[model samples]
Structure formats: structure tokens, C-alpha cells
Target: MDDELVLDPYPSKIPSLMDPSTSIGFLQPQEINLADQCFPRPQCDFFNPFRTMDGSCNNLQYPTWGQANTASTRIIQANYSDGYAQPRKSVSGHELPSARKIRTAILQDVDKSSPKINLFVMQYSQIVTHDTEFTILKELGSNGPLKCCNKDGSTPEIIPKECLQIKISDDNNSHSKHRCLSVPRALDTSDRGCNIKPVRQMNGVSSFIDASILYGSDHETSRSIRTFKNGKLRRQLGPNGKSYLPNVKKATELCNVTYDSTVCYVTGDPRVNIQPDMAVVTILLMRLHNYLCDELRSLNPKWDDERIYQEARRLLIAMHQHITYNELVPVILGRDFARENYLLPLTKGFDDSYDQYLNPTTTTSFTAAAFRSLHSSIRGFIELVNEARKITSKIRLSDFFFKPDIIQKQDNYDSFTRGLLTQKAQEVDQYFTEEISELAVRIPDRHQHIDLISVDLERGRDYGEPSYNKFRQLCGLSEAKTFDNLIDQMDKKDIDALSKIYEHVDDVDYYVAGLLEKSKPGSMLGHTFQCVVGEMFFRLKYGDRFYYEFGHQIGSFKLGQLNEIRKTTLGLIVCITSDIYSVQRNMFEIPSSRNPLVPCNSIPKLNLSAWKEE
Candidate 1:
């Protein structure tokens, strides 16, 4: 059967080419055709004072620059092994080391927790990542993951072209007896209309830091979630009487739901139920949106639903950007990096840094390699703590994959919220817990498991990302000419491990080498990753015309409104939205003598009076 002809829910721009082994030829200049959807054709609404749901018209000049469903922007050109759209190969014309083997060799099982920061840092990082980039995967006819391995643990006689199954060995303890990990290639704009362009992956979500995670990315999705009457998003009351995200019936297909009453949630982002931490954060933002609407409506009783909703949405997006730059970016990239690059939000005045010429689209390096290095910080289990900061119960993180039944239980929402704010995340390093390294997501009815460490290694190659040394040079660091010269950026032990597995210094994958390097001062990432991530954030701010801090843009907030947004923080957002009574002043960091837990009322909130209209 031609699986490409199958009805895929999220269809790709080009149909799958039938032959897997044939090298695709480039199209002649005259033969190249660009489909209408391939390029942005936004009908920008100037003077709207609001961003469109699909991210259109954000850049008035380049209507689709940061729009959803557009091709990702690349800092460095893709280096496909076939000079077109194939996965990258090793420098010696041989296959790279097996992903599972790389995992076992470099990443050890360790439970090292960060001393200064809490798991909220890791959890919120996921929220920011989901907001900025979401690479869509090729799907089977049933809209499910492609199954490449047969029941007998053998490759299919006629494998589908979409299947890039990770080859595994039986001796691998994590898999037990499974021999393959099914991994479908991410969908891209390759071979579409014979465009003669390099295969560039598509981002399912908008590249802008708009609240697409709360409201959907497209108009249809955004409308589906709204009530249309009171400017509130649809929500179902939890067993505890507090509002929660609306439920979907496709729990059996999308989630590992073990209960009958509770099903998977319907959120702006489809990956919401991927983990409980992500679920809690998504719910918080959803609640924040509705909360802002209620406050805005109370202040402006004559305002209609559309006016109230847009005003609330505008505030929510501003708060989201504020927390991301002020709290999240500083922690991950370091405060000094944030200041030096003008990545921080201004406290009082407008930032005159909007650049229409710059493309704010998520880069291949940031989405595929540099940003993914933070996976090392994820802990093995999701801890539930009481208001008193006492550990009541712990759930193995893997067991709850796509299963959010536990979160809907009595008091579990607040408990999990507190846990994230109080518990320390795994220290950012090369090590990973067994939960992620061994028992990651498993293929249905198959004994195989997806090792995320392995998946990250393979994803970089699949994206045709340049090797570590090249990226090092791109970041202005010394590129190693030989394996021995890697000592400057990498520890002696890390260089020794790379020398054993890789054929040459140039063959080291970007994600692997970046994670292995020592952390720069006061930053969670090493030099190359810091530089790449630093540059990525710089673009996300200046390249964005509707940045909350900017003054002269079509959607720019008033000076008073912008200043109130500056007062927003992760602590205040959590305090007002959820049932948590008190939290640390800086929820991103562990509660210390300087940054101690304070009553919710003590935390400064956006005085909605700034938004009151005459």
C-alpha cells in the first residue's frame, strides 16, 4: 500500500516519494513551482492593536515571517548528506554510532539536583519551547505513529519511506528483547512542487512568543476553544470545584489514560498531555486568560465580548513575554547574557529595537540542538508536595506519559503546582535519569522504548545540523582541528568519550558536544549552546514587531499598560491563578534567604486599573 496516499490529519506539503533508496534530483529553475500555502499570503490588518491567532501580519512587510505553518529560518544552511534532503552522515562515509549506544556511553544514570533552581525552571522552559517551535511528524493512515518494526521484532519486508526506525540491539537492557525503535521522519517542505529547495522542516505552531499555547495557533482552533459570550475559554470544573482544561474523548488514541472518568485534555498545544508539568503550566495560562477577562469585564462593564477578550489576551501575552524574558531567559542563559544582548524587558520605557528585516522564525540550531540540551535537567519522577512543602507522593514520570488522570484528583493540581515550585530540578549536565534514558515513550504493542537521549542525537542528524566543531566556530569559539584540541571547550573525560565513539572531531554531533562542555559562568548551558540560545532569544525579541516592550508597533501597549506588565512574574501568575496560597518570590529559583516564600497577597500583581478605559 502507498501509505503516503493515506488520509493524514496534518498533511505534508509534498507526498512521500515512493522509493527510499533513490537519490532525488534537483529541479530546474524553470520547473520550480511554489504552492500558495508554501509562502505567506497574509491579509494583514493594520491598526488592529492585536496579533492574529495564526501569527500573520506580525511583520507587516514580510507578512508570514513568524507565522505558524511556515518553514523554519536557518542561521546556518542545512548540510543534508545527499546534498538535498537526506539525513546527515559521518565524516568518514560510514554510519554514525548507534543512538542507543551513544546514550549508554556518554549519559549515565544520575540523580543530581540543581542547588539553586527548582523544577519550575525546567517546567517553564518546556512551555516557552512549545510556544516557539513544534516540529510535526509524518503519520500513518490512522493518524498514529508509524510502526516500522513487525510483531516478531523484524523490519518489514517493504518498509515505508517515512519510517526511519532506530536500530537497536537485543542486549540493550532498556528494550529487553525489542530490536527497533520506530521513529518517523518529521514532515518538511522537501520535494514539494519540485521547488529545488533543500528539505526544510515545518513548525506546526507560530514562531512568535504569542500566547498560542493558551489560544490556538489558527483561527479555527482559537474559535473552538472560546465560549464567544463572556470572552472566556471553555473549561470543565475539576473534582475539586476549581476550573480546569476542557477534556477530549480521544484519550485512548492520544493518551495512556488508565481511568474511565478522566480523559486527555484539549489545549492550544497538542503536546499538553505529554507530561504533568506541561499540563499544569498550560492550565495556569488558561486560567490566567479567563481571570484577566473577568477582571477586564468588571472594570469595563460596557465592553463587549470581543473587546474584553482581545484586551485580556493582549495582557496575557504581555505577561507571558515579561516572565519569559525577566525570569526564564535570565535563569537559562544567565542574567549577564540577557542584559548584554538587550534580551531583557524594559522596566519603564519603550524598547525601540523592533527590526522588520530580521526573521524571528525558530532556527534549526535552537529548535533541534541548543534548546534540546536542557533535557538533561529533567528529573525522573513528578513529585507532589503539600502547601507545607511536604512530599506526599511521587509518581514515576514515565508512567504518566500522556496520562493526566492523576492531575484531576482532589488537591493534586495545587500539590503538583507546589512541587514544581519547591522541588529542585536535576542539575543541568550530561547525565540523565533512567526514566528518560531507559523507559521513554514506547511503541504501541511493541517491546521497544524511545530513548530521548538517543532521539535527540538522531534528531540533530535528521535535521542536517552541522557538527559540533562547526557550530563552535559559528559561536566564535575555537573549532577543534583534532580530537585532542577539544580539551579547551570539553572536559578531559568528555573528549575521551567522544574520541572513542566518533571517527573524527568534526563528526561529533552538535547536541552531544554542546552538552558535554562545561557551563559558562552563572549560566545553565556551555559556550556554544549559550551562544546559539542567546542569539535565538535576541531574534525572538528584536525580530518581533509586536514585542510587548516596543512602543511604536501596531499592537504596542500604552506606557501604563506596559509598565504593569513589567510587574508580572511567574510567582504572581501562579499565586493568582491556582489554589496555591503562597510561593517563593522568584518561583524559578529555590526559596532562599533572599528569595523566600511569601504570601500570595504580597506578590505584586498587574493593577488592572492601568487597563481601565474612560
Candidate 2:
């Protein structure tokens, strides 16, 4: 309750804000620009050497954090009859100890065939995933482009894109593979379907209403907490898998237009619901912060724990304050506590002398540190209000969270720089230990990196290794290497050939399609990504044990959700009364063999005159 308790510093021997161990690099693309472009000013500097905010501002007097002595300064002295430049002081010898640097080197330089060999070292399997075209169905399949060309000149013949198929190889180690998505465009009623129409068809054109809402996180209706007798941590259960997709529910219940023409996102169950995906999103955000802090501390060796912690805190608070304050938002969201009120008490601790300062009361009933700490704990309770809004859009801060009418004035850019938010992801490589695929849907060809790096685990077998596990191994991730030899032949035709491997594949393949396919509109892939986000947070905030448990629960939930999606996929197919060529049946619930997503030359721009030149 006192100011003394909050303002008191650690003992003299303990490190202050001047230590080198703390720094949080702005990681996301949106966050990076906030730090680099919109912000960065002298006032935000954490360890101000001049110790005065009055008009006395001098770059020379400011304590240099990391930058070299590049500025020139002169302080007038009446006693100095002659002017002379001070000799350069070397700052390098105090080498940083706690920090570690990634080699910044790449795998292309590593010898894969050595004792530290990998899958690509030995060649393996190929896969062929063909996409269908949309025109093949319009006008009774009369006109459309379906072939493809060898854009890279890899083949002796340049296959016409309209009739072409793709092939990938793994002869030598490395990615050595490529695939392209066939884009599709719908025809205007003004053109193709303008034939003799049924009397009820208005303007000789047929239009259907789409029933999918913008992706919203599962809006939970229940928040019941259950306790366990043995003291094991309790976990939260998400919404029922079936109700997650709303369109699917609409189709079966509504009856008006041609039964199947209306596209919907229905699941079978009536009791299902949706809510904000907090578990994953929050966890990942924290993990990134921890990783950044830990990396900086490793730079200072002689630095004791006290010094390392304080310096890191100083560095983090400075950067965090600068970016968060100068960012593009209202001022209330970017408060930095340590800099303003708490002072001498924060500096009191050193060896045993500072112990008494930890909780001494101040006259004001609360110290500055105590005030800020209390504010944070109370704010954490209101975090869900923000999480609820994130489900709709990554940057829809105003809609869900509190938004004051006050504008972010032109000058404010110098204040709230750290609040920028975007989904731009960093690649999984040396700089980062891992990149989480925490989206609700698996984007098509999302596994290209894994496929690019995978190779044969054994010799001479046309058999190959699993694409998923191979990808993990290649990235140096800890995963059990199953299907030791899923890659059989390195022939460029591997994936294409795998597409036809009906006997060789299993439920897991479709399940994988379930995971990745969720990214496809109507497929609802964001749910899966939410799971990834949850696991990321568990690892970052709580550590590996929490991540493992959370991941297992998420995996189980996804498996259940996929089963519902599979039913929906079939429902959509059955509801289709028309093929690409014509309405095969007037009834809505007709049988179908064609896949809804097949490209069949559906991609148009690939053959565009402008694109052809490139």
C-alpha cells in the first residue's frame, strides 16, 4: 500500500537499467514497421545518462546503449584556454556474455551426406496433385483451358498448360520441387448460361445466396470450471465441433430456392457453437516475448543475475514503451510503469542491503511500482473482451476492444508505435526455433517446404517416407520419424504418382487434407490454426508440459471436427444437382463423383497475355 515499497530499487550491487541482457525485437511484420517506421525518438531512451528531461538535451551526454560514438559534442569551459578532442574510448572489450548468435549460415552449405545426413541425402518419393478447371463444366464442357506449361524449362517439352500435368523430383538433396495453384473465375450470367431458361428463372440468370459469415472464433456459451481431487491442472473444453460452421446448419433447415444451389457452412449437430480462440492466440504472443528476452540475456556473461535481469527489464521496458507509446493507437493502451515514479527504492538493493526496500510502505498508500502492478493484474481480467474481437479480423481493435473517439494525432505517431498487429509470419529457420501454422485452415500447398526438403530414408526402395515427418526432421524439430521410407523414387513425378496410390495411402492422408483443407473457404481451417496458436502459447507462457497437454486436447478436438467436415463435404457433393457441364438432376440431393475443389484448368490468369510474358 505504500510508495516506498514500489519505488525502492534493488541494492547497489544489483544491476540497474544499464545492463545488456534485455531487449524484445519487434517480431511480426506489422510490429516491425511500428518500431522502425513510425517511432524512435530520444525521449523514449530507457537509460538516460543526462538524468534530466528539462530543456538540457544533448546527444553526447546520453549514455550510448549499443551505437558507436558517431556524434560530435562540445561543452564550453571557461578554464580551458585551448580546445582539444577527447581520445576515443574502446567499448568492444566488454564483450556481451549472456547472448548467443545463430550462425546465420544456411543448409545449402552443410554436407548432407556426412554423419549428420538427412532424408534428401538419399532421394525418396514423388507426389502428383492435379487441379481441375472450371470451364470444363460450363457450356456443357465445350470450351476452356486445361493444360499447363513447363515454366522453368525443366522438361524437354513445354507442355501446353491446358492439357499439362505437374511433376516433382528429388534426385539431389534439397527442395528441387515446385507446384502451382490453378486459379478459377465464375462466368457472368451475361454470357455462358444465357440459354432458353425455365419460366421462373428471372432475367435468364440464376443467383444463389451464400450463407457463410466472416470467420469468427468459437463464441463459447459455457464457462463452467471443474476441479480434480489429485491437484492436477484442469483444462477448458471448446465448443461442440458440429455447430462451428453456420452455413451447413442453414442449408438443411431452410427450404426455398433450388435446394442445393445455395452454398452453406453447415455441420450436423444442432447444439454446437463458436467463440474467441484465446487459448492459442495469447500463448503464442507471450512465447515470442520470452524468446526475445532470453536471447538478449545470454549476451552478458560476467553480468550477475541481478544485473542481467535489471538491464533486460530496462531494455525491454524502453523498447516496449517507445513502440507501444508512439504506435498508431489511443494513448491509454501504451502505458510504461517503471520509468515515471519508482526510483531510488528501485536502486536501493545491492547484496543484502536492499532487502528491506522490497516492501517498505510510502506515504501515499501505494508506491509507483505497486500502482502499475495492480493495474496490470486488473487489466488481465478484461483481456477476453479483446480476444472476442480477434476472431473476426486480426486488426479489428476498435470493434471489440474499447475505442475512444479521440484521434491518434499526427504527433502521436511518436507514442503508440508498438500496437501494430498483422499476421505476417516469419519463416521457420535459424533465427526462429519454429514457426507455428496456427490458422484455422491449411492453405493449399502449405506443405511445400516439407515436400521440398524430404528425401528417401532408405536405399533402392521405390517406397518413400511420409511427407509430414520428413519435413519436421529436415527442419531439426523433435518429432518421431515414422514411415522411415515414404519417399521411394526421387523421380520428378513422385507426388503425381502418390496421388494415384489408393492402396498405399490411408485415413491419415484424408485427415491431413482435413487439417490443411480447413483454410479453403467453407472448409473452416481457421479452427485448426487456433489450435496451433494455443499450443504455441502453452509452450511460451507455461513451458513444454503445458503445451503437450494442450496440443493433445486440440488434436483430439480437430479429429472430431474433421469427421463433421467430411460429412459436410459429402453433403455438399450430394446436394449438387448439376455437374460442371449441366444440371444432372433437378432434385437437390443428387449423387456426385466429381470433387468440388478439383481445378480442371480452372485457373484463368495463367494463360493471360500479360502473365505469358513473365
Candidate 3:
């Protein structure tokens, strides 16, 4: 892990905006050839970047490269006169200091110790941000009536501010303020503001994290959440009979009725009821797809059920790209910038760096600002604990948001997999957790709450992104142009509180100066959000050509089934799907004294007899 801590690549002295001699300065090379005509590409001949089954664009030369543009929404609404402004108030009317109050004034949580990883790296960074950012849901008549700001004038002059809650004026008290209404982004043709549609999981608008975590990138929501027998899916038992997940009664009747049953389910991501750690990693990949369809029908006794569900969904997407490039990109990009960006994974194979013009898509500044710099590693509450760690039950990560009825109780999925292997996340720094900055989801029968740091600075200015010195001059760094050249990447009192809500230094905001820079050593990211989330995961693993370590391609993997899916981990997928016996063979680190606590059948598994069937 120390080839002299890697370094060297730097390069980019500015060009990119897809450099065709870069100038469409504020768009219009026929509107960038009409937003590249909504990405066409699809003529597959094996390289199943999760078979978008012709929903189009799976890297046929960067089909609309993860769409959405208008030149980054006209360079973040050209100094706003009302292209959606708001956030800079102060002069005592308050409301000024926000990216959740500079993440609650320079990340306070004073040494609660243990950010020795775990909590499955905050549930696999929200399942790799719902497989590379989705954001489309909000186009029913293109929204409108939001006014809000009542203060007790007893309601009614325009309400539904999506989920309002701003109210800032301090000096001790007062009333009415909640402010939500951001939503509005979906567009692609009916032209409200043009080009937007990169709902991800189309399998190739930059191969949107293709393993939609086990077969789901919309083929009618993967045939209404599959269950054609042996290649099983449709599960449902709970109240301790175990198994769970099959419900979706109209999306659990819009949640919130204080527990016991909103009944939401049917996974493979419709954001499986938004939280409970994304329904415990979509019920631990639907119990590793019915335990690899009963070990591929006991090693194929005349295979069928659609060829054992497309070969156990291609070995569960090569054990989720071998536990995301060998255990979460070397614990978040640090095994020397993931072995100097070959993004490590080739203990034996043909990795000729598959760059079909490197546009594995998802990059609107790494999906709305450096992969949400791990929202300061969450954790305002969600505990459970036991095997002598104690805690019992905690909850409040904003009441498990859209609550999967606290994952149907009765052993609550082995106390949420022993509180994700004895919990300890929160500490990416520049803090957050007041349950995601002041109650991110507190309905209280519609009084409202969600300010997730003003919904992450209004979703990076509703996905226009740009600022933070134009991504520190598109990641070649330098560009600060004074806050004294961002004092070697921030912290002169966060550059004097971002010079009192930024009047210049090109108006700051790229997720509030990439979560106030600093961490880049063994990496918790910083340095232009670790060079734009390590060059968008090194172009999603060298522009993926069905990238499971690319060995002699054609849907790679079979160097002994990619060495038994590189002995799949994430603590051997919670010791082969939950009722957690005992963990810590580095389930994202923390059990100290050289990572102890074993015995989940002493870890290491993935030996599906090199997927049998001779």
C-alpha cells in the first residue's frame, strides 16, 4: 500500500468540456448539437453493461455523457437576479451561514472516536449513490405553487413547498420559516428547460452502476421484481419467519403514518423506501439473489429458469464488481489513489485499460458535486448493537426516513446486521448530523422538516454545479484567485467563513467548496474532492467494457470465475446474508488490535465451484 503513496498523474491544464477544441462557451454549437440528440447507442454483441435491453446507450461512445446541460445551467445562473437565488441573507436578518451552518460550525462531534470505517462504509455510500445519481421524479405538470413563509397567519396562500423548513433568524426566538421546494429537474423533451434525463441505470448513460444492485435497471422494474422460481426473488416473510422485502402497496401508501406498516418493498431500487440503510443494502442483495439461485440449482441439473437467471445475474455482477473494486475502492480511494488509478482489481487478467473514449458517464461534477462528499459520513442515529457492544435500539437517523417499518422488526434483520458490524461512521469532517442537519425528515403530521443542508445546497444549484472555482479549474487545482488562494485548500476559519457567504472567489458553492477541503492523506477526500472523486472512479474503471477486471473481454470474468469473485467480501456479505453470527474480518474496519472479532464461519466464501455447469 505504499508504492511511495502514488502521486504523479496531475496533468489537465484545462481543456475538457469535452474538448473538441473546447469552445461552446455558454453552449450552442447548435446547442451542442442539440444536447447530442438524447443519447442513441445500442447494438450490443456481448458486453452486458447490465443489459439495458435496448433502453439505449451503454457506452457507445459516450452517448450524451450522462445528459443534462445548458452549459451547467448557464454557469450557475449567471450571478442570479432570480434564476433561483435565495441563500445569502445575514446583515442580521440571519439565514447566512448554511451548508448546514458550515456543517454545524466546522464539524463539532469532538472525537466520538471510531470512524475506523464500518456501517458498511455508510451502507456502501448510499449504494454508490443509488447507482450513480438518479433524480428525475418531479415532472407531473412541472411544479409551481410554493410561496410558504406563514409565521401564524394561519396558513393558505400557497403551500406544498415540497417539504419546507428554513426558518433562520436567531437572537433566541420567533416563528414561521421552513423552505423546501427544490424538486423540478426531470425534463428531456417537453422542453421546460430542456436536457435533463439521465435517470441512471439505463445501463449506459455512463454505465450507470450497472449492477442496479442485482437486476433492476427498469425492464418494467425488472419484471415487477422477479420470482420465476429457482432463480428466485419475490420474497416476503418477516415477523421473524425471516426473509422479507416484497410489498410496495402503492409505494407503501406514502409512508409516515408512525410505523407498524407502510408496507413498502419490491426492491432492485426504486430507492427501496429511501432509508434503513437503503433497506439494508436492498435486503443484502436479495439475500445474494436467493443464495445464487440455490447455488445455481445445485450446479445446473439441466438449467432453465431463464438459464439460471442469466447465470445468477452474471455472478451477481461479478460479486458487485468484486466488492466494488476489491472492498470499496480500497477504502475510499487511498490504497495509493487506488493503486495510482488502475482502480486495483486484476490479481490475474487482461486489463488493457479498456477506454472506449473514457466516458463512463455519471459526471455532473461527480453527480452534483464530488459524490456528495459523503454527507459528512451521516450517523445522527441508527444503532441497535449487542454481541456485548450493548446499545439495544436507537433509531432517529431522521426516524429511518421513509421507514421500511424499521425493517419489519422481530430480530430487526439481526439488529440491523449488528448495527452494521458495531457502528461507527460519522467523521468525514466539516460535520453534519443534527439528524442530517436539523431533522431532515420530521413530518409531525405535516408541520415539516427536511433541510439536509438546504438539500445539499439546493442539489448543487439544481444540478448546474460549476462553482468551487469551477472545480478548482477542473481539477488541475490552482484557480482559487484569492481567498488567499484558498489558503492551501481551506481552513483560515474556513476561509473566514467562506468570506461571509461568498461575494466572489467565483461564488464558492460546489457542494460548499467541496465540503470545506482538507482530508486527502489516507483519504477521506479533499483536494478538489479527491480530484473529482478520483476522476469519476477512474472513468468508472477504465471506461468499462463490462469491466469485471476485463480479462479477455466478452463479458469478462472466468479466470476461475474471477478467482471465486475475488473471495467476495463486505464481511463475506454479512456472513452469507444476515442473522449475523459474528463479523469484523475488516467489514470496513474498526474491530482494532489488527482487526479481530471473526467467526462468521470464519469469513471468505464466494466459491460457487467456479460456477459449475461444465
Highest TM-score: which candidate? 1
Regions of model 2 farther than 4 Å from truth:
1-310, 313-515, 519-529, 544-614
How far out, in Å, is residue 30 in model 2?
Answer: 41
Off by over 4 Å in 1: 1-37, 140-144, 194-196, 258-261, 442-448
TM match of model 3 to true structure = 0.33
Worst 10 residues of 3 by lDDT: 70-79
Higher-ranked by lDDT: 2 or 3: 3
TM-score for each model: 0.91, 0.17, 0.33
Candidate 1 minimal-lDDT segment of 10 residues: 9-18
Winner by lDDT: 1
What is the clash tally of candidate 3? 8
lDDT digits (tens) for residues 1-614 of candidate 2: 42223331211111112122311110232221121111123353333421111111212222211111111010001010111111111123221111011011111122111111111101000000000000111131455433232334244254431221223333333232433212111122113233211000011100000000110111121001111211111122213211112233243233122343232222211111111122121112222223323443444345444343333223222222222212210111111221221111111111112221111111000110101111111100112111111222123221211111111212111111111111111111111111111111111222332211111001000011122222222222223222223322112233333333322322012112112211211111112222221112111112111111112321111233222222222112211211222211211111234212232123221111111111
> Cα lDDT of model 1 overall?
0.78
